[model samples]
Target: MTDDEAGAAPDVPQEPVTEPVTGAGAGPAEPAGPAPLGLVRTPTGHPGVDAHLERLADADHLAADGHVEVYEDVHRGLREALTALDAQPVPAPYENRS
Candidate 1:
């Protein structure tokens, strides 16, 4: 091998490096916060059910570990609403006198 070719470095391909643009006229920087899941919650006709479902949104801003509390609260509320339905007193049938 020639002296020049022996001493030269190998020509390996490299990935291009990118840098964020800064200073005048750059678009607004992205927020350095957790992004919401953007899930849409449809409203249920029942207020109690709707409220419980809305409470689930609280988990969006929280870390994974914190989601349990929000989920548990929603679950408890929904369970209470269901239990309330069963606890309601049913009206007795009226007796008819001949």
Candidate 2:
């Protein structure tokens, strides 16, 4: 072994390396919209259902483009509609699942 290699300490603690801090426009860029709501891909067997899904996706994308408030309003409307649908009279339940 060389004299310098033999003399170096084997157990010394080294300074921890860190990633450089990012300033404005330095880090990874991101999409400028509310992330996708929980829409899942349905089986492509039904033509009518597939067409409806495509139309919904197109409208959602358009709403996301520089119109976040409108997108949120659509979300609210959807929620209200779902709530109203559930509130409508239904057959009596036999027992509570809870």
Best candidate, TM-score? 1
- Per-residue lDDT tens digits for candidate 2, residues 1-98, read 97669886677789997666555765455556654565876856655445444445544455446455554555665566567779999988799688
Predicted structure 2: clash tally: 0
On a 0 to 100 scale, what is the lDDT of residue 79 in model 2?
A: 68
Alpha carbon lDDT at 80, candidate 1:
98
Q: What ranges in model 1 sit over 4 Å off? A: 1-33
Q: Which pairs clash inside model 2?
A: none
lDDT of 2 at 44: 64
What TM-score quantifies how close candidate 1 is to the native fold?
A: 0.61
Candidate 1 backbone collisions, by pair: none
Candidate 2: C-alpha RMSD to true structure equals 12.8
Q: Tell me, what's the RMSD of every candidate?
A: 6.2, 12.8
**What digit string (tens of lDDT, one per residue) describes model 1 on residues 1-98?**
97668887666798886566666646566556655899999998999999999998889888777999999999999999999999999999999989
RMSD of candidate 1 to the true fold?
Answer: 6.2
Q: What C-alpha lDDT do the candidate models reach, one value each?
A: 0.87, 0.60
